[model samples]
Target: MTGQGSHPRHGLVDVIHAPVRLSIVAALAGLEKAEFRFLRDTIEVSDSLLSKHLTTLEAAGYVQIVKAGTGRRPRTWVSLTPAGRTAFDAYTESLKKIIDAGN
Candidate 1:
């Protein structure tokens, strides 16, 4: 058994565990990609807030961010990396384990 207070095997992933980041990952998990504005609105966060978390996720190699211009203005899109998808899957499985233990 692990020492007291030590993380369980397959414990929650720290980087993607944050509420906002979790929501972001969950949202992207089902899609090929999502527009920045769509995520901002769906997650109900400010532009800067979403941008900030996205940057963190990007740095962790969990997500990719792309900026492009269609016409007059630039657009940003976000998607999960393979690593992110794997981590998210693990996270959900860990969550299920925890919930089961509590039952």
Candidate 2:
């Protein structure tokens, strides 16, 4: 695992180390909060994949899931915690720096 300080040019390399997880985080970063289905559709991933990524993020304490009963169906909503937002912002900044360095 890469430490945040190891890659001065990419502080978020650790957070987005997995491509799928990276995409998941990126997608979540764009929304204030989103439904599970919405995230799955936006990311174009299967239920298993989305669930796996969400589990990972949840375990990392980067995301929060809210379960609510909506009539006959149950709705699951996901949102980034403050820690997640900070991590995502740092990751984006690192990516920008890397791109700038390459240019």
Cα displacement (angstroms), candidate 2, residue 20, comes to 1.7
Which 10 consecutive residues of model 1 have the lowest summed lDDT? 1-10
lDDT (10s digit) by residue, model 1, range 1-103: 3554544444688899999999999999999999999999999999999989999999999999999999998999999999999999989988887877778
Residues 8-86, model 2: lDDT tens digits: 4647557556888788888888889999999889889998998988898888889999999999999999999998888
Among residues 3 or more apart in sequence or in different chains, the pairs in candidate 1 whose N, CA or C atoms overlap within 3 Å are none
Error of 1 at 58 (Å): 0.4
Cα error of candidate 2 at position 18, Å? 1.6
What shift in Å separates residue 103 of candidate 1 from its native position after superposition?
Answer: 1.4
TM-score of each: 0.90, 0.86
Best by TM-score: 1
Q: How good is model 1 by TM-score?
A: 0.90
